[model samples]
Structure formats: C-alpha cells, structure tokens
Target: MTQQTENRTPERGTHVYDPATCRVGEFQGKVGPHAMLRPVGGGREWQADPGKIRRATAPERLRAGVKAANERAGRML
Candidate 1:
C-alpha cells in the first residue's frame, strides 16, 4: 500500500468505493485490517481492504442512491 492508502481511513458514514467489489458503500468501521462497508440504503456489510478503497464520487453516490430507492420501491408493491 502506498503512503496515501496506508494513512487513509475514511471517517464513519463517509461513502467509499471498493475496487475489489466495484461497489460503493458507507464506511462503518474497521475489522482487523479490513474496513467494514454497508450498502448505501442499508444492507449486509462487507469487508474491504482500507488500502484499496477511495471515497465515492458524486456520480457514483447518485447511482447508488437511485438504485437503493428503486429496490425499495419494488419491494413495496
């Protein structure tokens, strides 16, 4: 991990992108060496290396939010 990766740990509640999973999630906390992340609208959390994640971009966040809303709407029928 580079210095940036080694030193960066997103604050809790921040949105980050996990390249390994190609998904955006809210940073929950750390577990061992992995950062725990949850889906934007709330769902099961997954572990991702802190060294491999970056903050989510605006477009990414928008997409995730829309997807979550759609999912919820689908389930409401």
Candidate 2:
C-alpha cells in the first residue's frame, strides 16, 4: 500500500471510496485523511480511504465477494 503524503492530492481521474457508506465516487481532492468527491448525490461531497476505495471498486474484490457468498450457500467448488 502507498503511504499517503501530507502534500499529496487526489489524482484527477482517480476514484474515491467511502467505507462509511460503501460508496465510490470520482476523485476530487483531500478532505482530511480521506479523498473527497461528488457521488450520486447532486454536487454533494464525501471522504473515503484511498486504498480501500481502490480495493472496493476493484474487479477482484467483487469476484471475491461473489465467491464468498457462493461458498456460504454451499455453491463453491
């Protein structure tokens, strides 16, 4: 994981993740220890963990979640 720097700003086209609400958004800027962005709401801003945002939106995590759910249902190989 990349250590966040005090001077580092959110990448222009990067995505933001909000663990509090389990939501993702286009990167805007830093709003404290988290990334800020406007999500589904009309021009509303939210903060999220940068690393978690990436992981939460990653295809692998999605696949893992699906696999886990399937396993819980006794559908895994």
Estimated TM-score per prediction?
0.92, 0.43
C-alpha RMSD of each candidate structure in angstroms: 2.5, 8.7
Provide the lowest-lDDT 10-residue window in model 2. 1-10
lDDT of 2 by residue, 1-77 (tens): 34333445567655445566766556776666767766532247766665445523475345545654666678434
Write model 1 residue lDDT over 1-77, tens digit each, in one string: 23227577779999898999999999999999889999999999999988889889899999999999999999999
Best by TM-score: 1
lDDT scores for all predictions? 0.89, 0.55
Residue range with the least summed lDDT across 10 consecutive positions in model 1: 1-10
Candidate 1 to truth, TM: 0.92
* Model 2: CA > 4 A from native: 1-10, 40-42, 55-77
